[model samples]
Target: MAESRSETLRVAWHGGDRFEIQIRGHSVRVDEPKDFGGSDTGPTATELFVGSLAACVADCAERYLHRCQLPAGVTVTARYDLGLQPARLSKVALDVEAPGLPEGLRESFTAVIRHCPVHNTLFRAPEVTFHVLTSGHEAVCHHP
Candidate 1:
């Protein structure tokens, strides 16, 4: 095994149900639709979460095709089911289409794409901790 690496994403509220995310010098926004009391400015956080998985699968498939000198035409569609009680995602389904790929490599292709990081993470959950800060200090400084 190798040493683990960490990355950070910064998110700030941008009024209402909207938030701005900053990652590696790029900015993305997340919000709810108008029906959910949001301005419909961007995709909701749940959408982004599933999008990451789909994108990872697509990228992995494309890389495998390229490595084998095959024509690249990969598409991944993802659908998720939300669960109640705790308001969490319960299941995710992915449909991957790799047109023009040879028939013999179908199983291999599936195996490779299944190893995508986002998909593997779902199998082994990560630990999370929350911290609250006030003013410029650690949960103590007060603001006026």
Candidate 2:
């Protein structure tokens, strides 16, 4: 780890539609439900997005609380409303509960959530560029 560094994450298939994700020093697994051709071994893609937002906010709040010398008790529950017409994510609501926090710092906590990178990014349309690579079958893999 170093100051002002850029990092890249990697994700590869483990087995049976379950993916192995390498991030920082952690290995995460993402899988589909049994009905969707998976054994329900891990969280699905939709769950991952909800979980990421919750976890990111919690991480930000935790740092702020630590700086304020507050006791550690932070919880974030994320709920999503799916739209059927386009099979899209309609809305995501987060219920943050911090029992050990002081009332005086409540405003700052709201600001922290507003300023959280993940939170802000979710509201904006991302510029996603797709790149396709072609090979001559020289390097073939069973993995997707």
Candidate 3:
């Protein structure tokens, strides 16, 4: 039998291009166009995407180090290349810096990065499904 996976995140939009994101039942506010936004102030959507990738990797690294009972400190800096003609995410580069860690632990941490969910998901190009409901009508869109 396969192991079960379950988690839920909810997002609701407030007035004026502001949104509330609920992750595992906790609420966070996010907005766009910094000049007239809340919570994150003025972080663009694309910036947030890159931030998520870095955060995901860092989270996994931290967990792996803790599990191995190794003292490690990791910091990741991610840069995105968005200079394509059609305006798509061209490349993502990450700089991982670890200080005060055992020698072998660094190699093990590198392995953990390969298995990080965000890294795996990005490489797989998983399908996305969108649902729209308006005026008692519903529409679904699937991308493969």
Candidate 4:
């Protein structure tokens, strides 16, 4: 049987282009740069998006090394380019480094990290739907 899971996050505006996000009991803040008219308090959401991918890849690499009974030291540097026409990310590149990795294991390690959940998600886009709720005495939360 396939395992199923559900995750939810809440984001609330914290004044002037800043937002506070709650994720599984941890809180993170995100804001735009001063040039973008924000207070420059924290990383932008776009940066977090790319960072999540990098972290996921690194985590996969580390786990693979641990399973092999080797030191799980992994580093991932990520770069992305934005497409102005669509105002979206057009290119993303990741450079993963695992020092002292055996040459024989390099190919397998690369293959393992490439299958990270974040990488898989980007390769297959998920459907998104939005529902708007307005304040009213009779309003109630609905799940679908």
The predictions' CA RMSDs to the true structure, in order, are 4.1, 4.6, 4.4, 4.9
- TM-score per candidate: 0.89, 0.80, 0.74, 0.90
Using TM-score as the measure, name the better of candidate 3 and candidate 4: 4
Better of 1 and 3 by lDDT: 1
Show model 2 residue runs off by greater than 4 Å: 1-5, 137-144
Q: Over all chains combined, what TM-score does candidate 4 have?
A: 0.90
- Cα lDDT of model 1 overall? 0.93
Clashes of each: 0, 0, 1, 0
User: Which of 1 and 2 is ahead in TM-score?
Assistant: 1
Q: After superposition, how far is residue 139 of candidate 4 from its true place, in Å?
A: 15
The residue ranges of model 4 lying beyond 4 angstroms of the native Cα positions read 136-144
How well is each residue in 1-144 modelled by candidate 2, as lDDT tens digits?
256465688888988989988999898889999998997888987889889889989988888889888888789999998788778779999898888788988998889977776788877956778555567555545864
Q: Could you tell me which 10 consecutive residues in candidate 1 have the lowest summed lDDT?
A: 135-144
lDDT of candidate 3? 0.77
**Tens digit of lDDT per residue, candidate 4, span 13-132?**
999999999999999999999999999999999999999999999999998988998887789999999889669989999999899689999899999998999898988988889877
Per-residue lDDT for 1-144 in model 1, tens only?
288798998999999999999999999999999999999999999999999999999999999999999999899999899999889889989999999789999999999999999989988888879787678866555776
Ranking by TM-score: 4, 1, 2, 3
Q: List the residue pairs that clash in candidate 1.
A: none
**Local distance difference test scores for all models:** 0.93, 0.84, 0.77, 0.92
Residue 68 CA error for candidate 2 (Å)?
1.6
